[model samples]
Target: MVTPAVSGGDLARVAIVGASLGGMSTASGLRGHGFDGEIVMVEAEAELPPDRPPLSKQVLTGEWPLERARQPGSATLDELGVDLRFGRRAVRLDVATRTLTLDDHETVSADAVVLATGSAARRPPIPGIDRPGVHLLRTGADAAALRAGLAATPQRVLIVGAGFIGLEVAGSARELGLPVTVVEAFATPASRVLPPAIGMALAAAAVDAGVDLRTDTSVEALLGPGVEGAAGGDGDAPVAGALLSDGTTLAADLVLVAVGAVPASGWLSDTPGIDLDDGVLADATAMAAPGVAVVGDLARWWHRGAGGFVRVEHWDNAIEMGRYVGARLMARDDAEPYTPVPWMWSNQFGAKFQLAGHVSPDDALTWIDGTPEDRAWVGVTHDGTTVKSVMGYNRNPKVMRIRMRMDGPDGLALVDLLAAESTQ
Candidate 1:
């Protein structure tokens, strides 16, 4: 059992940065844990933070209204006695004093501070990237702009990455009958997360859906209009296409750069004692300092299961970490190390892909229920002994059950259990 970092009674006020899903979750968890202290949430965006998962699918496809993507409204936070500070960005932090300097030059000092600044979309240092018609989807504004761009009906849609976001957007584009081309630097789509076999199987579905999936390809540069053979723009105007490393140029009226994101930890660069290596470093208890806790994508904390520190940017991780840190701060739950089986899901080509627990490309994967060719399967990955992760495509029930077992002793005996079930 880990010891609580700060007692509930000692916390007179708590200041949360980002107002992201994780930040909001922390605030709500504190209130739910009976913390009557003042709760202040400072967000860089003036409007309420919107749910991001929908931005790629429903929001992009115009199936869901943009207003429906909002997580919790001001009224909801107000009911919990939260002091919502919208449009206020934290520019600096003094961990020792538990004071945060906002971009507006206002200093907010609290008994405890929670860092949930999250991440920002990574825009590669390529020329013509700043031009119109080239978009990076991270925020609600980005989604709206991309959606509007799609409404304009570009002849060719080019996505510069085969990550979840890029693939989901590709599926959405295809659903609108637009010609989509996805370029991935890796051999498979979502190679950073999914194993090659699984990614290739999903890539087949995208191809079947009329997406021109290009693997092992990279975008050298975004070609602006007036370039030789560039389409859809006048001289020196919006992005007309891209120059690939293979010496091939693809004409794209619209380009979505979904390469990846980086932790929003630049403000804490000068802050002493806070280790900033890719993200804000924290202990297994999610505590960064005596009264400081870091949650969400910005937290790079020790994972007992992984045997090292990991920074998870998934939506579920944000919620779980927020609740755990909140309970720890208030001393509400047993002092247990924050160890969670990281889970993430994506929707593409009308199939739901779910992955639970940390997985590596090198992990040995075995199909437990169905084959990948079926486009609906449940598989588990193992490190020669214990199961490390479970992934499924449209097999939610089996995948979830296996995922739940991963936290128990049965997880280690999964192979034997599956063998036994197979004989029956």
Candidate 2:
């Protein structure tokens, strides 16, 4: 809880650009906190924003209907008296005026503004990426299109990148009994985030689940029908396969590019006084500029715990940061700085992996309970003293308990965590 620089009573209208989870949470929080300001939510999509986690799992596998993926609908926002402006894209923002310029040339002025535009899936410059058969999953439309592609029963599925999104899609494809091949540039899956040992453990799980996990590989180019060594051309033919860096060709009717995501901060490129180094740079309180705050994937805020700036794309971070910003706007006095232990979960190959706190490959990883080979295990990441993060597979109860203990300022020590586990 941080005291907002601007007084809540002085705010007559608060405009939230992008009706994403973070945006919606801020609106709900402002109203819940007894601020009687006008809330106008602008969304690019016509339909209400849907939950993204299911897009890679249940939604992609057709296990859950598309409707189940939807978050709070219009009725819920209406009850909160939120002026939902759908099908309008925000084009620019004038931080000085706290005004937003929509693509339709409509201007929205507010006393305070919240930017929760979120992020867009990255489609690497690999040729033929825009081909009809290729896909990127970041929005409801992307998920729907990928779902339709999966329904087509392609003979083989090729996925680029072995991050959480790519791996989740691979898991879903496996559930559908489809042959899947995954290519990752790292030596192991999720090496950028997790330690090599943990990545190898996850890689082993994927391999055991029948995924053609190809590590240390990159896609040189995507191939089209009858196009030898050349990427797709002007013709609208779908992608047929991909040529790997190893000079090998893989036949895959459907290609999913899940490399990563880029913050949707392009609209603010020309906006002065706002830092956009990979994302909108903000202070610990999540404030970017006067009367303007950013949340969700678009926010790369300073993390007091990490001693630096970090942009977390986890669903939990979005909700927590949104609520924090919302409450901060209504606060009258100073409160604690926003220092949250990040948390994220993933479902793949019927195993649930949960990670809490910020983890770095440089951190010392020590398995506390069981080894990675076990069905249930827990690992602690620390800088030889204080615990930095905790990761677990199929052990939710223990992982969540340890995660809670990490909330304090001086976080739980590694010795204490291990001692507590030993006593258990």
For candidate 1, give the lDDT. Answer: 0.86
Local error of candidate 2 at 373, Å?
1.3
What is candidate 1's lDDT per residue for 14-117, written digit by digit as tens?
99998888998898889888899888889999887789999999998889988889774335866777898988899999988889998879999998899999
Q: Model 1: what TM-score?
A: 0.95
Once superposed on the true structure, which residue ranges of model 1 sit more than 4 Å away at CA? 1-4, 72-75, 229-236, 332-334, 420-424
RMSD after CA superposition, every candidate:
2.2, 1.7
lDDT of each: 0.86, 0.88
lDDT of candidate 1 at residue 250, scale 0 to 100? 88
Specify the poorest-scoring 10-residue window by lDDT in model 2.
1-10
